[model samples]
Target: MDERRESPGQADGAGRHREGEALPAPPRPPRGEELGGGGFAAEGQYFLKYDHSSYQQFRSWAPAVLFWAAVLCSIRFPAAAAAERSGEESAPPRVRVVIAPTLSYGPLWIALEEGFFRDEGLDVELLTMRRTAEALPSLAAGEVEVLGSHILPSHMNVIARGGRVRIVADKGHHDPDGCTSEAIVAAPSVIASGRLDDPARFEGLRVATDKGMSGYFYIDTLLATLGVSAEVLRTFDLPLSSKEAGFTNGAIDFSTAAEPWLTRLVRSGTAVKWKAVEDFVPGFQSGVILYGPALLDEDQGTGTRFLAGYLRGIRRYNEGKTDRNVEIIAEATELDPELVREACWISMRDDGEIDVESLVGYQRWALREGLIDRAVAPEEFWDPSFVRGANEILRSREAR
Candidate 1:
């Protein structure tokens, strides 16, 4: 049989240490240490030195015990380690979007209907206000998080007033020879006299729009291109809701308008098409995405999430034949499907990219006409980061 050796904590022939290795001595007591029992004798016997009346001795081990206990606890438990490793939470909050009832917002409806925001873990509520100007004030007041109804001049006016609104994305750009949803509507009398071809026709005509808005800018620019000073035409400031009636009642000889109103005017004999915006300013980006300084301060994640979700919807809507998407847009806009289909096929850039060049042109003309204080830098106005992020999401989904 093999012989076993004793270890430091055991008696000879019973301890766990190897037989050839020397055992370490037990730790020595401090000077003047009291002995609870007499030291071990040569025969391995122990005896108490103190009488029964005396107090029992204690070891000075509180600090050492606590140190070792902490080490042991850390080794056995893991939640503390995990707590140190994880950083702050990054979950995004809900994004409230303000939109208009214009045809340019078709993409947003498509995105909502297709559940793209849901897929991206975002909660988006879209509220359609009556006009972009109203939405701008609400956005400035923090009542809304995003605005998609902001056209160039309205945004510029806000900036001029020292508001910190910035364009973060594009809606749709105009296409050449496109069936423009925008029309410079004229009275039947103006159309009958061949004023549509006469550069001098608008010299004395009063035109109405939300003053200092892009609608006004577009019409003014068209007149300027015809060598007619904007000062020559009587410019009227009218609420968008009043535009159709204003045109029909002869309150204004002409006015600029977007869809449904244009459709209404055409159908109801209130307005005649004097000019198509696309014919004069092809590739002009109509609607834009905007956010005020408060929104930019509160969260960037919300913006990213909204864009990602929105882009996903765009891709889904454009998935196959555009006709299906057009039908969907028509329903959302409350226009005849055929009219919506015709407008969709013509008005929007086929590729869904906003025309930056056209915007640059619009700005130049606005400066020349003195609509804005000065020519705002293109970089100062538009923010494409959200658009880029949205496009990336689309590309990634396509890959999958």
Candidate 2:
């Protein structure tokens, strides 16, 4: 019953505080510890009880977290960094090209065989179709990136309709020096009759052609150039494969033929080369390398690289139809090597130069023949920038 005990809640002067005004609760200890004191000696020093259970739990999971973090960093960072450093972490870009299964695509085959495309960071796949018309839809749809064939009347028709296909590079041309694949052939009966000796005798003769194709136009132009009225001759559309049979049966009197068919015809004594197309249409562009809109407009670099590699192959091809090249051509075309060696090789410009005037003239003729409804300007169909840029690159490499 002392005065200090009279009010139990009041301060007793023994480091005790009034009940309602309890000393501000000791500052809460930091995480993982509890606060305690050991009397007056330990007054200022907090006795923190270590949270060993919690520490043990954190320790148990730390290695796993660190391990996962390291794994994620490696997965995210090193591959990208290594790819940047090596410059070859990814495979080369692939270009899907379509071509007719004809010797006209010699440069493309040469490019594939000689690794020209590989040198340009491209993986080119050459798909062979029986005809260009079969590939045109794919070209328009971007399913096919390139087409190796002639600029046909049908192509002009497509251009007139605002189609997105374009002629980017020249594949083959009619050389004035008699280096040409196309020729006018007459059946042996016609040759034996000596009618081929006179150009006028070609009048009123039936000619076979792959209608809607450049060959049809070639025969038309050839006759006109030779002073024979194209109207006088009757044209029958026939596939090149069937021309041999037609000639054998005397159904084809006259036809524009390309090697190795021309060679095969002569060797088998079924027909004879009456005249080379180059004789009249000198420097005529018979075949071209076409590009779809996706390649020409959206992905121009690939188009440029393809042309560069194609030009390299063309330059190599122009090295004078060697035996090795004949073998290569034979292997690609599946024709006999002897026939390939004997057949006339189409002339392609070393620089992939296209005869723009010839192309325009062909289009004009197509318009006149009602093949195309309107004329499409050369600029609309020909984009020479890729070819020009490719040539510049080739020249720089040669200079280097």
The top-ranked prediction according to TM-score is: 2
After superposing candidate 1, which stretches have Cα over 4 Å from the reference?
1-92, 157-164, 294-297, 316-353
Candidate 2 lDDT, tens digit per residue, 34-102? 111110001122122235554454456556556544555555467667778888565456677776556
The lDDT for every candidate, in the order shown, is 0.60, 0.71
Quote each prediction's TM-score.
Answer: 0.67, 0.75
The positional error of residue 269 in candidate 1, measured at the CA in angstroms, is 3.5
Cα shift from native, residue 41, model 1 (Å): 92
| Candidate 2 RMSD to the real structure | 30.8
lDDT comparing candidate 1 with the true structure: 0.60
Q: Could you give me the TM-score of model 1 versus the true structure? A: 0.67
- In Å, residue 149's CA in model 2 sits off its true spot by 0.6
**Model 2 Cα displacement at 214 (Å)?**
1.9
